[model samples]
Target: MIRVERVGPLATIQDLGRPGWFDSGVGIAGAADRSSLRLANRLVGNPEGAAGIEALLGGLELLAQRHLTVAVTGAPAPASVDGRPVGAASVLEIEEGQRLRLGLATTGLRSYVAVRGGIDVAPVLGSRSRDTLSGIGPEPLRAGDVLPVGPPPRTHPIVDVAPVAAPAGDLLTVRVVPGPRADWFADAGALYRGEWTVSSDTDRIGARLDRRSGPTLDRRGAGELPTEGMALGSIQVPPSGQPVVFLADHPITGGYPVVAVVVDADVDLVAQARPGQPMRFRPC
Candidate 1:
């Protein structure tokens, strides 16, 4: 078992997320950095989809109740165990009562921490991921939260500890494909080719953007419709004509028309986007 002595501003347990639950009105909620989460799990020999802690921004202090092997990845933060500096991307042997501290990240918005057997939490809707939008899954972690460590698998395995590359800067270029309602605007496609800034209101639900001067959208007779299923990368345009790119914890449905969908590979970039950062969309 592990106890959270201090939890950063935002931290939650997440895995690969609950897929195929959309039909039942369950939203897919998981680590913002899916690739990093999977890699951290692989580094600790945990199942690729095992539930782990997702630290937003940074700064998390944990105490191990028992000896455990752990790994930290994503957003490259300075990690230390028992006052000894540990590699940010490699596995470490933690002894009982040892304190693990992760400082603020130099880059990226979220970081993932994985244990040997994975965190044991009651799965909700077949997922341990927390849905910030729907209030599903486990609640966000707070100080003094003790997480149980599941039974380690029978077979032991070796793992590589190569560091994952960090993103260049806060400004990320994302790939977007034409959305279902691409024809609603006079030059809808032109928006994708222009540059925009991520608004401060961005979150797991969606990222609002600052629209640049371009083609005007036809709002006449285009009133909002009933909420419909929203995909992971769907970019919805509200009546204000501002584009909002959906993220992992986005609402299950929305009424605004979707003008574009970010490519699957680029969705991770949106998770790291900070306010006031420039993001230009390009055709996939």
Candidate 2:
């Protein structure tokens, strides 16, 4: 069992996310950096879909009430177990009554911490993820919230840490393909290839891209379109012409025209990007 002695800015349980529940108004609120979460889970012998804590901007702390193994991954936050420094992505023996604290992240925006047997949060709509926009499942973890730890299976698995680095340069290379509504805009490929700056108005919902010229589209003959289902990597262009890349916690539906969609492999890179960072799209 783990006790939350101190919860930082934002921390919540997340797994692979409950896909196909969007029709029921449930958003997939899984880890923004899915690779890191998977790495942590593998290190601790947890299932790939096991729910773990997703710490935004780091600063997550907890006290272990039982002897268990834990692993941290994602952001480059200096971590410590019982006041001693520990490396991220490596398994550490967390003994009972030991305190663990994570400092601020320097490179990425979010981090993942996986524990043996995973966090035992009651799943909502088949997911342990916290959806702030839809108010589904548990709320953001706060101080005094006792996180339940479940018993693990008899067998244990070993996984070596695969070092992942932060994306270099202010300009991010995001791979994208023609979207469903690509024909809605002129020069879809060219528009995406152009450089766009990440605006301060970015979050789990979406990252707003600042473009110099508005997207040119012909909607004169088209009727008022109904709101359509949105995907994780969708890039929508509203009347403002600026593109907004949907993230893990984005709404299920939107009415804006999707210019291009980022490739699944590169979405995590966008999710980890800080504000004011410049990004350029490339055709897949």
Candidate 3:
């Protein structure tokens, strides 16, 4: 078990997310950077889809109630156990009553922490993911919360350390596939040409882009688009003319036309993009 000492700005338990529940109006609410969560789980010998803690902008501190192993991944951050520095992507053992502290991210926006047995939070809808948009699943972590850890796997930890590239850069290039409503726009090619800036309004639901100089994308169809199911990477353009790239906690349905959808593989890049970062879209 572990006790949450500080929850920072936003921290929640997440797994692979509750899929196949869209018909019931549930969005797939999983880790923003799923690859980091999976890698952290793997390092701690937990199942790939095991529930772990997603720490936004770091600043998470925990106290271990018993001996266990833990791993931290995503957004290289300063981590320490009892004041001793530890590597971010390496496995570390925690003794009873010891405290683990994660500092602000040096490069990325979110960091993942995985315990050996995974966070044993009660699941809702077959997943432990917290849907920030719909207020489903567990609430965000708070100070003094006691989080139980499940039994560790019988098999030993596979790797001692596995470092990944830091998800930070000045410019982020995302590949997109033409969306079903591409014809609604006057010039679909303009999306690829304009250099958009990640807006401060970005959140788990979507990343809003600010195109300062280009002409607002003119809609060919004047009528309102019928409400339809939305996907993880759906780029929905609202009346403001700015594009919003849907993320893990996006709504299940949207009324705006989806101009394009980011490729599945590049969604992680979008997740790591910080506010004010320059971004460009490319057709795949």
Candidate 4:
């Protein structure tokens, strides 16, 4: 068992997420940065989709009740085990009573921590992901929580370290495709016209961007669109003329008009962007 001693801004157990549940109104709410999660699991010798910790802006601390192997990825947060510095993307060993700690991340918004055996939290709707929008799966991690470790897989860890680039500090650009309702906007190109700034309100639900340049997005079709299924990365434009890129925990359906959709690969880029980060959308 691993005991959570502190969880900073936010922390939750997550896997790849529950797909095929949108018809039932459940959105897939896995790790916001899926690539980082997969890397963390791989470094620890767990399956790519194994459940792990998604620590927001870092500050996660855990204690090993027994011998354990673990790895941390994403955000490039400085890590220490019992006050000794440890590499973030390298395999780490924690003995009984040893504590693993992560400080505030210098870049990126979230980090992933994986144990050799994935987190064995009780799954809800076939996933351990905590949907911030729907209240699904286990609740956000709290101090004193004890997380069970799953049985080790047949394979042993082969990778010692993964040298991933830290999330970018300057303006990050992502590619996008037109949305189903692109015609609803008077100026569909408004999205790509500006360098956007991530809003402070951004979370697992979605990333709301503030226009740093370019024209406001206005809807040509005034009447409200009936509630329709929303996909992850859909750039929905609400009445405020601002575009919001839906994230992992976004609602299954929404009534707003979607003007653009970020490409699947770039959605991971959006996930790592912190508040106030500059962003650009390029039409593919």
Candidate 2 global lDDT: 0.81
Evaluated with TM-score, which candidate comes out highest? Answer: 4
For residue 272, give model 2's deviation from the true position in Å. 1.1
| Candidate with maximal lDDT | 4
C-alpha RMSD of candidate 4? 0.9
lDDT of predicted model 1: 0.84
Which residue pairs show backbone clashes in model 2?
none
Model 3 residue pairs with clashes? none
> Which stretches of candidate 4 lie above 4 Å from their native place?
none
TM-score against truth, every candidate: 0.93, 0.91, 0.97, 0.98
Question: How do the residues 66-86 of candidate 4 rate in per-residue lDDT, one tens digit apiece?
Answer: 999999999988999999999
TM-score of 2: 0.91
lDDT of 1 by residue, 1-284 (tens): 99999877699999989988888888887888788898888888888999999998779999999998898988877899988998877988899999999998877778899998999999998999999988999989999888999998765557557656785465578988886877666677767665788888887788898855445444446566677888998988888877888888988888888888998888888887777778888876
lDDT of candidate 2 over 237-281, digit per residue (tens): 887667899998898898988877888998888988877877888
Q: Regarding lDDT, does 1 or 2 come out ahead?
A: 1
Clashes of each: 0, 0, 0, 0
